[model samples]
Target: MGSGSAKTYRLAFNGTAGQYFGIWATNVALTILTLGIWSAWAKVRTKRYFLGNTTLD
Candidate 1:
């Protein structure tokens, strides 16, 4: 058992994590390459995906 920051956590493994990482990496690469428009989209996707996948009390 854990408390506070030590509380146990697990990945939902909804199976899109790998794809998310791929999108993240590709977005980062494109951001660097494009001087950063991809960053805006990446941030939006990341926020949406994170909120969509998270479960909280």
Candidate 2:
């Protein structure tokens, strides 16, 4: 690679639908049970799930 060459990276998501469904279901159930109070935690959980399953190469 040349010094001035631009670096390229590929962003990939490796999360399966089943895995996400489980998270989504739990978040939904908890959010409803807590009267929307769990939404903040659910957002964090969802973000972590996606970020954890993503890769850069």
Candidate 3:
């Protein structure tokens, strides 16, 4: 890197509270109904929502 205008990396979170709540609620319900058996899938979906919304700018 030179002393000139250096490159910069920015990270952003674009997830809204409502969107996250919806996903979280769905996961909770499914997990409960399945007697915690669906918890793994629910956790995956929850993680995916956050990961997908995270952006690099």
What TM-score against the true fold does each predicted structure earn? Answer: 0.55, 0.89, 0.81
What's the alpha carbon RMSD for model 2?
2.4
Q: Which ten residues in a row have the lowest lDDT in candidate 3?
A: 1-10
Overall lDDT per candidate, in order of appearance: 0.76, 0.98, 0.91
Q: Relative to the unseen true structure, what is the C-alpha lDDT of residue 41 in candidate 3, on a scale of 0 to 100?
A: 95
lDDT of 2: 0.98
Sort by TM-score, best first: what order?
2, 3, 1
Candidate 2 contains a number of clashing pairs equal to 0
lDDT of 3 by residue, 1-57 (tens): 577997799999999999999988988998899899989998899899989999988
Instruction: At residue 43, give the lDDT of candidate 1.
Output: 88
Residue pairs whose backbone atoms clash in candidate 2? none
lDDT of 2 by residue, 1-57 (tens): 567978799999999999999999999999999999999999999999999999999
Query: What is the Cα-based TM-score of model 1?
Result: 0.55
Give candidate 2 misplaced runs (Cα > 4 Å). Answer: 1-3
